[model samples]
Target: MPTSHCAYDTRLLVITLILLRGARAYTWSFKEAPSQCGQSTVAVAGNDGTPPFHILIAPFGPSPLPNGIETRQILDIPFTGNQSEVQFQLTYPTGSQFIAVVSDASGFASGGTGVATMVTNSTDNSCFDATSTVQFDFVFNIFPTVAQVVQCQNLRISTPNFLGIIPGGQSFVIPEGTITTDASTGTGFSYQANLRAGTTFLLMGGDVRGNGTGGSVTYIVALGNNDGSCLSNNSPSSTPGSPAGATSSSSSPSSTSGSSAGGSVPTET
Candidate 1:
């Protein structure tokens, strides 16, 4: 087997070959992002007798990856470890192509964790950006709460590679707080606060397709225009403690004279 350094050099040559030899068009590979399980893992493969690229993250150990994809814009690897605390060790070689996003978030994490893969060129003799290497020392935790006069806190949102918020229309606005970019989701990010009860918010919550997480529900939300309403699942609403009942925080209703028992607003799916 070629030494790990040899593998890195080879991948660099492959990137250059694709650029110079014009192998098809745009270069493509996996888009690494942070996860909820404190780590991310994927098995990257090469064609023919080529030795595949193996990426294992911290927090959760991963296995040799399996490869199968229909497109190049996205690369899907079999990941069986913690999704949070995703970071690459780059055991292959030094002169490889990869990007790492850090600086502020580079050194942060409380509940889960965050990892970002920026675009890195391999022209230099470095596996990662000369400025940033793959790191996984952060532990971020985000909690959705229901408190009156809630203290403003930064919510760590490890935006997914393909998940996104609805554009052109008013993005979701909660009444009590404000939203801003805690960090780049990739294309960018947004924050939300000052939210009122029942305020409909929007976000690209990871991809619906190839989402390996089970018991977790996925949906395509619809938004309305001025005086518009957010679209949601038509499934029957769930009461608290209902079987696998709803657990996401939601805005409450307008002030109306009613018994406190009626105050408990069940979250409709």
Candidate 2:
């Protein structure tokens, strides 16, 4: 019954951020594939202060698996347009391999404009100045043993750090097409966000696990201008004065992170 829980909701542990040079991306995720999958090429335009840009995510069918371990997949696809940052590691798995769909080809998305793909699968990609929308699909491959894929998502990568999605303190390298995990190599996930201005706006997150279940999601926002830097200018004005922001001031942990396994991520609301 809750809209979103602010504490320990694993589905909200990872965040994927995308920023474009002239537009904003309209991001949407799916757990059980869209009502229509890999069928439509129609792209809807998104607004990001700059001009309006439309884009389409080409469909990439269900993944091919290896074990009967109930395949589990986690994708960190990115979409972009104007200068917008999407919080990924804060909403999905860590070390998770993501497919880069950067292209300038005439696709349905981008309103006939063009998309360029750029993903070295690098770290704290600040120069992610490249504009393109990435569609990452994950297949949960943990069957015969468990049904739940993720325990949490969106863990606040406020500071790009080293680490990937960790379940029960375990880590896994997430990529686009394949869902994989290493019980021995503990997963590592860490992130740092400049917010350009840090917390000045509302940020929401969600986690998708291997079992084909949409984990859970939560949203947080900056309340006030805590510093005097143009970096802190990105925050929305309506936020509370007590929230966190200002490129000059570092953010203190104010929220909780969690995930779901046996059942849905406990509503953090």
Candidate 3:
């Protein structure tokens, strides 16, 4: 009887271990079939002289329809030292909204840090109207060294720009009057810019100084026009950039006058 009872207890222990491991694993799913979704290969520069790293993205939200069902999705973007550039694409159901949790997968595990930046442009003239606005929401897991956003005429060429600092959890917006914070949190905030038709902007967040402990950040980018109707087709392409305090030798983009404060353009890594 003693031998039989011991065997039963051992089996129960194994089953409990398996269940605990499965709980930590996260899966990705969507309410409707995604029209476009795929991964790309790219190179990510390391922070403080480390090797290239990878980013893990987990997207979750409800369908745009009234009383829509909620869903989730996951993607892992790998960056190597040999590759120069790559493209990633995802198209959500029309009118639907989602938020993505982005993290430095490899860097966080290895105790390294890096920059996270997403570059997006609107070339479709029809998508904009008199009320169009570009919105950005950033949720910081830990306060990063620096977080800001910039609007440019063209990302490839230097031009006049608009820069705004993202004050995590602050009641006020930076650079005084360029934009306004729509929402505030103890560790995050949201803001919007009334940009003209056909605009290119960069959303930047992450600890480039290797000062932050391993923590994930949430990012949401949306375009709304026609009186608050969400635009679903304008997904931005993300690419890592250089560390703080590094100057680019390239010529500065020409000055273009804007109502917001002006600053030198940041060099992309």
Most accurate candidate by lDDT: 3
Choose 2 or 3, whichever is better by lDDT: 3
What's the lDDT for all of these models?
0.21, 0.22, 0.24
lDDT by residue for model 1 (106-204), tens = 111101111112122222233212333222122121233222111123233333322211111122212223334444231223232222223222222
lDDT of 2 by residue, 125-178 (tens): 232122322222321122211211122211222111111221111111222222
In candidate 3, clashing pairs total: 2
For every candidate, C-alpha RMSD to the true structure in Å: 20.5, 18.7, 21.3
Output the worst ten-in-a-row residue range by lDDT, candidate 1: 244-253
Model 2 misplacement above 4 A:
1-39, 43-186, 196-220, 224-269
Q: What TM-score does candidate 1 reach? A: 0.17
Candidate 3 — what's its lDDT? 0.24
lDDT of 3 by residue, 1-269 (tens): 01112222322221110101112222111111122222322232333324344433322222332334222223344445534232454433232322222123422322111121111122222321223222222223211112222221112211111221121110111112232222221323323333222232222232332211112222222233332232233312221132211111111112211111111123332
Off by over 4 Å in 3: 1-49, 65-67, 80-86, 89-91, 94-106, 109-269
Per-prediction tally of clashes? 36, 97, 2
lDDT of candidate 1 vs native?
A: 0.21
